[model samples]
Target: MICNVFTQSIKRKYLVLAFVLVCGLTIMVSYYKPISHRYMFLPDTQVANLNFYDQNVISGFVFGKGTPMAVSCPLLLSGNKQEMLVAQSFKRTTRIPSFYYSYLAKNCSLFKSRRNYITSSLTLEEEQFPIAYSMVVYKDVEQVERLLRSIYRPQNIYCVHLDNKSEPEFRETLTEITNCFQNVFVSKESLDVRWGTMSVLEADLICMHELWKYKSWKYFINLTGQEFPLKTNAEIVGILKNLNGKNNIRKSVLNRWATRWEKAGKAPAGIIPVKGDLQIAVNREFVDYVLHNKTAKKFLKWCSKTKVPDETFFVSLHYNKHLKIGGSYTDDQGNSTDPPYITRFKTWEGTAKPCHGKYVRRVCVYGVGDLPLLINRKELFVNKLHLDFEPLALDCLEETLYNVTRNEYFQTLEGNGPPKHT
Candidate 1:
């Protein structure tokens, strides 16, 4: 009787194991429901849906160039709904480079958990204002990734915009790069990063608008990816703290603050320049005023009718409306002492209003590349510097970080934080 009982028990165990194995296989297949499995990563023929995420994969966002960014915005969402491989499955099947986060982790402390920043003396808490970077990636994306790795701390976030005209392969690569950021974001309009004139300011507004909407960051700075720092982060905090101690930043902002005058029944054509766009330092109050002001919002609404009305639009408003409040100072150049505000770099030589008149495209070199030449616009917070200036800016060191341009970085206290992890 004991032998018979043992034999029966062993048979039951085998049956139970077989049932469990079958159920496990069913669940695995459900999670990985095969959708046109292609053993390719990031297809060039068309950007396909990534199949493996617990989340739904949508159209790929691109980065384009110029002030208004004619091409970038259209690329925001894709209409391509072709049958494709899952991003996870494709990645597993394809032989691409193994992934890692050396840039966002070691370089910028963008993610929430890693918010420590190091500078000469700026303590993290003392640095009252927030900073934002406006970056556009074109070719040399690998170099761009390296630039992101070297600069921008977590305290400051990067708003990256790509041009739409870039190759599909490059676009897919960029998508992978920015996915690592909690703080870093891809812009809505993917303009041509290299060609468009409006791309510069367009990127600025995008960053400012989104940062204002999402994060509590008080200041908005427009920094390019290629140009590294000229000053230590700590010195920046000190400068901003000192500025706040003296000025009323709320009444000031960087925009063309021109109000519409009732002249001969024409539309509101009046305009003036703001102070922050002067390539200097900024405080929280100023950023809030321009980005959140009811009057400014109305002004923007009015200006929308003007044909590509970006140039001098913000400037006219900022300088004219706020001038009475003792907020902004102007510089005509060829005059000795630096204006109350300072700009870090020289602008591309051309009349800003080319669309209304005859304007020629210009080549820019910030470092070794033939990038579009641009001044570190004090206005628009930070504008694209000619890439030729990157190494120079890197060498200058202190100037890039803390000096007061017209309307840029803020001041604060010294920092005691962890050294970067290489």
Candidate 2:
């Protein structure tokens, strides 16, 4: 009887051990099952243990056919450390002011300062570098030279796409200079053919789509070549179109910047810049509203079929959405004081371009063209400021914009996010 009881206990112990092993195996299979099949192009994401599916390989594809292969998996945004992607359109600023590197070195993220800063473009190498998506179109040799001196640096990740129509020699010359810059990336695009509203907008969208590949940024800002940054206030107020968040600056956006235009015998309606107004700084959602959303696309398509009027394109959508976006172009006193965007405009010299060379000396305006400022009373962005006027632009950036960017970085660190405007 004693032997029988002992044998029974041993048998039960063995059975329990077997069960535990099987359970462990099952868990392991569940954990790594996703790794079995490979995904060729995984979209930028912030998830671990991602799901995987098998590859399909039937015959050649036909029109309207075999379910277009899914390219992107559902993105899981990382709420932990949000970042921004600044899409800057630049020709080159090598001849610009002296303090460019000084500004970035002092204020921009210094991942290199810490041990083990991965400089490689591939993998999770970079710590917190903001991806600067720069579209390069028709930069004079002088401008390109100036850029090498001023803004081109390792910290900046540039998606520098030049127009395809540019002379090969120009590309060759630019590439030589670009090669000198350690982190400068060169890209070419076949988009020179279209300068219309849809074309320009499409290129802008294309730049964003390409930019999305490099960095995982929370917001993307469209920057111009001539545009300078005067101030970047850290304390941003959300113009919450998402009203539950407490910001509603969307009320101020004015849609009709123009009066009715007479179509001049097949010459596409010519609409002048609204006195002093230019483009807007709408949010990512609003941007997508015009670019991707179905209803918005339909509206844009209808517009494209006609004059493809840019004025109505943005304004109409903002009106259609009945949405309020957020961004502050003002200072504490409600003064328009974004530093980089601010400038001391001299009287316009006689030239085809709005901004000719550079202001050699500060003179009061008695001119053909006047300096333009945004509706918020803030200066929109300057044109014509170049290597010649580098000192002034540099001073403006150092004293004003750089400080704001620094503060903004800290504010982000401290948990307050980006500022908003209409």
Please report the TM-score between candidate 2 and the true structure.
0.41
Give the lDDT of residue 324 in candidate 2: 33
Writing each residue's lDDT as its tens digit, candidate 2 over 1-422 gives: 99999999999999999999789768855653232222222233411212110111111011111222221001101111111011011122223121222222332233132111223322121223233435444545434433332333244445555656766655555565455444555654546624445565555555555555554333344443444433332212122222221211222234453332223122112212211211444445554554566665665555454343543455445433233323322233545333232222223345343431234343222111121121122432233344334232222232233334445455555766544444
lDDT value for candidate 2?
0.36
List model 1 lDDT by residue over 1-422, tens digit each. 99999999999999999999788767745754332233223354323222211012100110111112112211211211121111111222211121222222333334212221222213444334455556656654544553564344556667777767766755665666666566677887675543224454455666566666656454444555444443334334444444442222222342343442222133343443332332334444545655776766666555454433354335544445333222332333536222334223433445252121111244223331211121222222222333222332221221222222201222221232422211
| lDDT score, candidate 1, position 116 | 19
- Superposition error at 31 for model 1 (Å): 25
Error of 2 at 105 (Å): 19
Give the candidate number with the greatest lDDT. 1
